[model samples]
Target: MPRFMGFVRMVEGGGMPPQALFDAMDKYIGEQAQAGHFLDGGGLFGTEDAVNFVVRKGETTRVDGPYAEAKEVVGGWALLQYDTLEEAIAGQQEFAELHAKYWPECEMVATLRQVSDEAPEAASA
Candidate 1:
């Protein structure tokens, strides 16, 4: 089975979902885990706790958030294993629908990216 990553982004200025909605999400995630669709997942703290780093030439610059230009931030992520890209996308759609149904007022986005099977090789001498 191929693996896919589902990236969950929260719109700027949107607060966390209510406890009832959070519980519903937890239940949905548990169902997916029990069905083997979910591999691993977790939510992240607000972007105010994040740090940004940029490397140019040989110099590395570190900047602390709140990021000025960021309109949205990753709020959570999930790793899913499926037989095909379409299946992965369908799964993501279902998850997004749950959010739409439960947190209608919240603005969120979910994106799916297929995971590569290739492993990195060591540098050649």
Candidate 2:
């Protein structure tokens, strides 16, 4: 099975979603977990206290947020596993649909990407 990461991106300060959305999401996550599709997942706070380490010219500098230039931030994420890419796509689509159906007033994007299992040495080529 291949693992996929689903990122939920939206503008900061979107505020909490409706309770109905939360209930629907809870049920949806429960179903996915029971199906062995969801491995781990959680929502995240906005980048008010986010930290960034930048390395340049053999020196590292630490930067703190909230970043002024960011238009969208990852509000939530899910680690999932499936037998095929189609299954992953379908799973992501279902998740996105839940948000669309339950929180139609908000705008968001669901990004799905496969996790690479390659060893660091093999990937360095």
Candidate 3:
């Protein structure tokens, strides 16, 4: 089976409670796990977990925080294993549908990338 990186971008909504969001994600994790579709996943806080860097005069500056100014940022993501890209896409669509049911105003963007040999390895067995 081919593995895919599903980059899930959460919609911007400061009013949403983090706990509620996490609870929803937990449901997805549970459902996917039962289906054997979930390999790994995690949710992240905002720029607090991000790192920023700059290079000048052969010197580099490392800053801690979010790097992008976009209104939408990746709140979390999951890796999925499937037989083909179409299957991955279909899985993502199902996820989106489920999310919509809970968060009617929330929107998510899922981008699928085929895993390459050069990709980082999973730390767990």
Candidate 4:
């Protein structure tokens, strides 16, 4: 089985979604977990709380952000394991559809990427 990460990016300046939407998401997540498609997931704080470090020419510069002109910021993520990429995509599609149906006012984008098999230890060895 391959693992995938579903990145959820919310539109900037969008207000908090309704409680019913959260409830529906909770139920969907629970169902995915029960079906063994979902492994782990979590939401992140706003980008205002984030810090960025840039290393250039052996020097490091630290910067704070509401990161400039960003249209969307990653708001949440989910880890899913599936037999194929199509299955992983299908899972994300379902999530997107749920949002479309329940939280149409909340603009969002969901992207799916397969997890790489390479581990640090394996790469070093």
Candidate 5:
């Protein structure tokens, strides 16, 4: 089985009620966990308040900014382990549907990659 990272994106201020989002997320987590697709996940704040960085010439620089200047930004993400990309995609679609009730334009990103147990830690650039 390969492990994947799932990212959920939403345009800032989509006005999704907090309780509704929470309930949907909870239900989704329960469903995915029961299916052995969920490892862990969490929501995030605005990108303006997110931690980010840039690296150049072997030097690392911390920046207070989002990767892109789009109305939609990554609001949260999860670590998932799935047997195949198809399963991961299915999970992503499910999550998007859960968010669509309040966040009709919410987008989802399912980045599927085989987890490498021996992957080395990246040096601070």
Candidate 6:
């Protein structure tokens, strides 16, 4: 089984989703969880107090957010496991459709990436 991380990115400060969307998601997630597809996931609050640590050259510096340039931020995420790429993609599409059907007005991007336990080839030393 391959594990994937699914991120739901949306515009900043969209306030809250409609209760209908929440209700729909609850039903959807509950079913997936019960079937052992969904591992864990949650929605995030606004990034008013977000912190970032950057290392440039040999120095490290800290930065705080509500970043002016960040138009879209990760609003929600899920940890999922499936049998194949097709299965993962199909699940991702279904999750995205929930947002499309419930919140047609807001723009969102659902990103799905496989989780790698080892470092990439570029990181080999």
lDDT of 1 by residue, 1-125 (tens): 89999999887668768887888888988988998999999988876878888999989999888876898889899999988888888889989998888889988899999888899888996
Q: Could you estimate the TM-score for every candidate?
A: 0.88, 0.92, 0.72, 0.88, 0.70, 0.92
Task: Please estimate how well model 2 matches the true structure, expressed as its whole-model Cα lDDT.
Answer: 0.94
Query: Candidate 1 — what's its lDDT?
Result: 0.87
- lDDT by residue (1-125, candidate 2, tens digit) is 89999999998898789999999999999999999999999999889999989999999999999998999999999999999999999999999999999999889999999999987665563
lDDT-wise, the better of 2 and 3 is: 2
* Candidate 6 TM-score, C-alpha based: 0.92
Each model's lDDT:
0.87, 0.94, 0.74, 0.89, 0.73, 0.91
For model 3, the superposed segments whose C-alpha errors exceed 4 Å read 11-13, 17-25, 55-59, 66-68, 118-125
Off by over 4 Å in 1: 120-125
lDDT of 6 at 58: 88
Model 6: lDDT to the true structure: 0.91
For 26-47, candidate 5 gives per-residue lDDT tens digits of 8879988998989988878777
As for candidate 4, its clashing pairs are none
Once fitted onto the true fold, the runs of candidate 5 whose alpha carbons sit more than 4 angstroms away are: 65-70, 105-125
| lDDT of each residue in 29-52, candidate 6, tens digit only | 999999888999998877888888
- 1-125 per-residue lDDT for model 3 (tens digits): 88878786865444564465557777877987887889997766787567868898889999876555667777777888887789888988877766666666676776778787586888994
Best by lDDT: 2
Q: Tell me the deviation in Å of residue 92 in model 6.
A: 0.7
Score candidate 4 by lDDT. Answer: 0.89
Q: Which stretches of candidate 2 lie over 4 Å from their true place?
A: 122-125
